[model samples]
Target: MTPPRLRPLAAALALLAAAAGVLAAPAPAAAQSAADVAVAREIFIEGSEFAKQGNWDQARERYERSLAIKRAPITLYSLGVAQQQTGLLVEALESFRAFLVEPSAPATKEYEPLARQAVQDLERRVAALEIRLSPGNVAGLAVKLDGVTVPVAALDRPRMINPGTHVVTASARGYREVRRSVSAAPGSRAILVLNLERDGVARPAAGPRAVAPRGLPAGEVAAAEPAAGNLVPIALLVGGLTTFAAGVAVGLVGVVNASDAPTRDGDAADAARAQALAGDLVAGAGLAAAGAGALVLLLGRPPESAPRAPAPRAAVSPLGLTVRF
Candidate 1:
C-alpha cells in the first residue's frame, strides 16, 4: 500500500532496531566476571605452585579459596587432586564428581577420565559406619560421633568416615547416656547398635570385678567401674624407699671420699669436705621424705575398733563432788 522509496526506508529502520536489541542483551557469564576472574586466576596459580612443592594441604586451602571466588572446572579438578593427596578420600570423591557434573569445556574436558577414575577408587577406599538405635523413636534424642552432632535425617544412611577409632555417644531425657567406641578400617563397613535404657532402671553390677558378657557386641559392652586401689599411698611408699636407697648409696660414696681426705691435701681435701656436706644434705632430705610417706600411709588406713573408754566417775569428796580422770 506504500510507495517503493518509503518501503526501502522502513526496511533499513527495522534492521537498525534488530541490531540495537542484540547489543542491549546481557553479555556471556564469562565476560561479566572480569575482576573475579583476575583474582581467581592469581589464587589458582598460587595453589598450583603449592601443589608443585608437594604441599597438598596448603594447595587444598588455596584451591578452596579460589573456587569460592569463581567456579572454574579446572579449579574444581585441582581441588579434588589436592584433597585426594591430603587423605580426604570422601571429600575428593565428591569434588571430582562435582567437576564432572560441570559442562565439558576446553579447559577441563581432558580431566573427565581422571575424575571418573578417582570416583571409582574413592568408592572402594572410603570407610562407612551405620549406627542403628534401639527404640529410635525416643523423644528428645541426640546423637554424636567423635563429639560432632549427627543430624536426625542422616541417621538412616551410612556415613563416610576416616579410618580410625571413633566414639559414638547418645543421650535422651529420662534415659541413661550411652557411649561406645568403634574402630573403622579402610574400605570396610561397620554397623553399631546402641540400646537406650530408661533412667532408674537397675543396671548390672558395675563393681571393679564386673565383666561384660563374652558374646556381646563391642557396642553393647556393659559399663564397669574402674578398679579401686590406694595407688597414691603405695606410690609414695615405693618412691620414698627408692629415694632412701639412692641416698644411702650417695652417702657411702661421700664417706669413702671423706675417709681419704685425711690422707690428701689442697683441692682433694676441699673436694672431700664438699662431698660429705652434699651427702649429709641429701640423706637428711631423704629421711624426711620417707618419714612423711610412712606417716601418710599409716594415716590413710582405717582405724581399728577399740574398747570404749570407761565413763568418767563422779565421787563425793570431803569438800565437794569430784570427777576422776
Candidate 2:
C-alpha cells in the first residue's frame, strides 16, 4: 500500500526503469549476436560507472570498446559526453552528430536536442587551419598536420581542428622540408604557407673543383673545373702516374745492369737478376693502380644531360567524417 502523493513518484520510477531497459537493448535494425549484446551491455555499464567517478579517459576507452563491439545510440551519446569531458571537441562533435543521425526511439529521443546543442557549441569552439604551398602542384609533396598525414584533396579547404598549437610539415623529393608551428584559438581561422626550395643547389659549383689548389696554374685549374667533386680520382691519377714514372726509370736502370752483367762476375749477374725482378713487380703494381684510377675517373664523371626523377605522390591518411543532417 502506497500513499496517494507517493503514487506519482512510483509511476515515474517505473517509467525510468523502462527507459533504461530500452536503452540497454539493441536498435530494431541492428542484428547483433546475443553474446555481443551482453558484452556491450557489460562494458557500457562499466563506462557509466567510470563516468560517475569523473574518470573521463577510462570512461571514453570503455565506451569506445563497447561501441566497437556494438553501436548503440545510448553508447554514442555517452561516448560523446566522455569525449567532450576529455577536451576532444572535434571528436565529440562528430560523435554527437553520429548519435543524432541514428534511428530515433522513445529511449533516445530525449538525447536529440542535447546532441544538437553540443554540436552547436562545438562548432563554435573548434578552429580551422588553411595550408598553402608555394609554387603549388609540387611533385611528391607530402604534408602532415601535428604528425598526422593530411589528405591532398583537403588541402584546398580549411581543416577543422582543436584549439591549440599545431605543427605543420611539408616535404618533397629533392626539395628541402618546411616546418611551421601555428597557434589556433577557439573559432579562429589560421593560414600556414610552406615554401619549398630545391635541395643541394645552393652552390652549383661546390666541392673540390670550386677552388684551385696551391701552386696550381689558373689555366690548369680552369681546365679541371669540368670535373665536379673529382678530387679523389685526380689524386689517384697523379699518384699512379708518379709511381709508373719511377717504375719505368728503375726498369731502364735494371735493363742496363742486366745487359752489362753477362760480361761481369757471377755476383754481378745475381744482383742484376734481383734488380730486374723488383723493377717488374713495381711496374706491374703501377700499371694496375693507373688503370684503376683511370677507370674510377671515367665512371665518376657526371653525365651532362641527366633526366630528373619523376615525383611520386604521397598517400594521405583520412581524417574526420562527412556528416549530413
Best by TM-score: 2
Name the regions of candidate 2 deviating beyond 4 angstroms. Answer: 1-31, 201-325
Off by over 4 Å in 1: 1-33, 199-325
Q: Over all chains combined, what TM-score does candidate 1 have?
A: 0.50
Q: Quote each prediction's TM-score.
A: 0.50, 0.56
- Candidate 2's TM-score reads 0.56
lDDT per prediction? 0.69, 0.74
lDDT of 2 by residue, 133-236 (tens): 87568889899998999988889999998999999998888777888889999999998888777665332333233345577775676555545446556666
Residue 164 Cα positional deviation in candidate 2, in Å, after optimal superposition: 1.1
Relative to the true structure, candidate 2 has a C-alpha RMSD (angstroms) of 18.1
Question: CA lDDT of 306 in candidate 1?
Answer: 22
| Model 2 lowest lDDT segment of ten | 3-12
